[model samples]
Target: MSLRPRDMPKLRDQTLRHLDDPTSNLRAKTGDENATGLDGLASHLRVGGLYWVAPDMAALAMSSGSQLAAARWATADRPTPCGLIMFDGGIGHFDARGVQIPIEACAWGPYEGECMLWLLMSRRRLVAEMARANLRLDEEQAPPLLPVHGFTVPVTTQPAPLADLDPSVPLPVIAALAASWLLMQQPNLIDRTRERPDKSVRRSYARAGREDPEVTVVDLRRQYVPDTADPDSGRDGRHYRHRWVVSGHWRNQPHGPGQSERRQTWIESYVKGPDGAPLLSTERVNVWRR
Candidate 1:
C-alpha cells in the first residue's frame, strides 16, 4: 500500500468496508483477537483512529516521542523507509507483542503485531504526508505525547469525535477542545491558543448536532428539584439521564513528564423557583481549564 495523498481516501474506504471480514487475508487479526468475529481487528482499528504502520517505522516514531516527528523525518536522510506504505513481516498480521501508543485522537501502531489491527501511520510518516499534500488538522489539538508499548500507555483515549474522519463537517470548537484534553494535557490550549478561537461553546454544540455531523452527541438534562419543594405540590420534574461515549481505558492515569491527570466533573446547576418547575432549556457544552 503506497499510501500517498491520492491513495488515502480510496484505501481508507476499502479497509473500512472489509474490516469485519475474518476470512479475508487483509483482515486485521487472525486468531483469538478475531475468535468472536464481532469485535474484529478492524473494528478495534476503527475505534482507534484507523492509522496503519509497519514495525521499524512504528518503533522509530515511538522512540521519537512526538507526533511532530513527521516534521523531522521528512527532512532527514534515512537508510530504510521510516515506514513502508504497507508490509507486515512474514505474516501480514504478525503478532509480535506490538506497540500501541496513544497520540491525541489517533492510535499509532501494532508495531510488532500484538493482534489489534491498526490503520495507523507512524507520526513521522503521517506528518510527512500531510506536509507534502493538502492535509489539515481541524480538531486535532492534543500535543505530541511520548509513545509507550502496551495498552497501558496511560493516555486517556477520548471518545472519537463526530468529525474525526470526516472532512466535510466543520470543526466543533468547545466540543473538540473538551475531547482533545481527554487525551493529553494541551499546554498550548490554555496559554497560547485560548484567545485564538472566538467561536462560542453554545455555537459549537448547536451547529454540531443541528447539522447531524457524524457521531451524535446528545445532551440530556432533567430538573430533579421541584420549585415548591413538596412532593404533593403537583410539580412535574425528572432526573437527568443520557449516555455519552467515554474513554474506555486510561481513566485518571498519568503519562510522560510531571503532568498529572486532573479530576473532571460536569456539574449542572439549578435553583428552586416560585413556579412548580421550569421547562427544559437549550443545551450547551462548555470547555474550561482553570
Candidate 2:
C-alpha cells in the first residue's frame, strides 16, 4: 500500500531499464509526419486541464529516437506560457515472449522546465495494492492509482535545474504533494468526443476502452483587431494598440506555515492590447479542446 523509501532506488532503476530496452514493442515511426497528430493533441492542453494521453502519443514518447521530438510535442501547444501538465495513459513495452504489454501510468511536470516525471504502475499491481489496502472508489470516479515512485526524463534539450524538488525526500511523497497541488488548481476536465453526423444520437459517457480516443476541437484562440474609429472605444473606454490572446498558465506563490513554502497558482487566459490598435502577430494556433 505504501512505498518504502529503501525500495525507491530499485524501482527507479527497473523502470528505466524497462523504458530503455531496445527489444521492447514501444517503437514508433521516427518522422515529423507520425508526430503531427500527436502534436495537435498536445496543443490543446490548457493550464490546469486534464488530458488522457492516447496510445500513439505514449508510443511516440517511449520510442528511443523520439525522446526529444516527444518532448517538443508535449509543450508545443500550451494554453499558458508555463505551468503543470498532467496526463494518464497506457505505455507499451515488450514482455519476455515479445508480447507488447500495456502499463498504466500518470505523469506530471514541467517541474524543471521541459522535464516530466512519470509514475509507472501496472494495472494488476494497482488493483492488488488497492485490495490489500482496502481502498475503494465510487463507481463514477476513476481509480486513483498514483504510483509511489517514478523516474524523471527530459522533454527538451535544455532542461531547467530540478531545484524545486529535494532529492533527500521520498519520491512518493513528492508525487502525492504534486497530486494535491494539481487538485488545488481545480483542473478543467478535457472531454474527448466525436461528432455524430446524424445529430440525433444521444451523448454517452460510458467507457468503451478504445485505443485511439476521439476528441473534439474547441478554438479558444482568436485574433483581435483594434477599432480604428476610436482607439479607446473598447470596454471601460480602454483599448489596446495591439491585441493578442495570452495563454493560461501557472505561477508560484508563497504559502504554508510562515509562508515558507510555495504553491502553484493558475493564471487565466486574457486579451492583451492597451489602446485599440492593430494586431501584433498574424500567426494563429488551431487549438483543440473538448
Candidate 3:
C-alpha cells in the first residue's frame, strides 16, 4: 500500500513540523551529524584507494535514495531518507563516527539523517531481477531502450581478445548497461511497464571476492538511482523517464604482443531512455507501509 499523491505534501509537512529529537543533539539536515559521518566516509575511502574524491558525488552532493528529491542533504535539512552502504562488508547503518549502527532497512525510512539505516543488499537479488527482465549488466541494451540524455562518445571499435578479462567491464560500459536495464524496469502507465527493480552494486570487489583473478572478472562498481525526469516525459503526454548511474572497475589486460594494456579504468556515465522518454500512465506516488 502507498500513500496518495495529494497526501505527500501533508506528510512532508507533518514530518518537518516536529523537530525536537531528544535522542541526540542532532537535528535533521543540520549537516553537522552527517558531516562528521561523511568525513569519516571520506577518510575511509581515501585510505582504501577506492577512487578519486572532490569531483565525484562521493565528495560532492550526498543524500538519501529515491525518496529525497534534492541532491544535497547536509545538516538540519529536511530529512532525506538514507541508507548507508559501508566500505566494509554488509549494508548497515553507521553512527556520526562512521561506525556501523545496527538497524533494519524498514527502520531507516522514518528516522531522519541522525538515525539513518545502512543496508547491505544481496548480489543474488540483483542477479535475479536482471534475469527476470532478461537483463544482464554484461550484455548490451537489448532493444526498445537506448540512451536519451547523454551525448555520444565515439571510440573506434575493436574486437576484444579471448584473453581479455571482463572485470565487470568498464565504468562507461557499466553505466550503459545499467541505464538501459533501469529504464526498462521503470514503471509506465500507458505502456504499463515494470516497477523499478531493487538493485544495488557492491563497490568492494575484494569483499565481492576474486581479486586480480586473471581469468575471472570482478564487478566492483557502485551506482545510485537519482530521482529525476524530463519535464515533458511526465505530464506532457504521460511519459516516464528513469535515470540511474553505474560505476565499477575494469582493467583490459593485453593478451600478448601488440596489445595495449590499460591501467585501472574507473569509468562512469549517465544513461537513460527507451529511445524516447516513455510516457507515464499516472503520477500517483505509492507510499508503502513500513
By lDDT, the best candidate is 2
Which TM-score value belongs to model 1? 0.24
Error of 1 at 14 (Å): 1.7
Q: Summing lDDT over every window of 10 consecutive residues in candidate 3, give the lowest-scoring window.
A: 143-152
For model 1, the stretches where C-alpha displacement exceeds 4 angstroms are 1-9, 27-29, 36-40, 44-290
What lDDT tens digits, residue by residue, belong to model 3 across residues 1-290? 32221222222212222222323222333346454433332232222211111112211111111111111112211122221111112122324254333211111222222322112222333444578789865321111111111111111133222123233222232232222222222232012111211122122334556232111111222333432333223355543354433222232333335665332122223233344544344445332111
Model 2 superposed RMSD (Cα): 18.1
Q: Is candidate 1 or candidate 2 better by lDDT?
A: 2
C-alpha RMSD of each candidate structure in angstroms: 20.8, 18.1, 23.5
Q: Model 2 residue 136 lDDT?
A: 59
Order of candidates by lDDT, top first? 2, 1, 3
C-alpha lDDT score of every prediction, in listed order = 0.28, 0.35, 0.25
- What does the lDDT come to for candidate 1? 0.28
- Any residue pairs clashing in model 2, and if so which? 80-248, 239-274, 239-275, 239-276, 240-273, 240-274, 240-275, 240-276, 241-275
Candidate 3 achieves a global lDDT of: 0.25
RMSD of 1: 20.8
Decreasing TM-score order of the candidates = 2, 1, 3
| CA lDDT, candidate 2, residue 167 | 59
lDDT of 2 at 80: 32
**Per-model TM values vs. the true structure:** 0.24, 0.29, 0.15
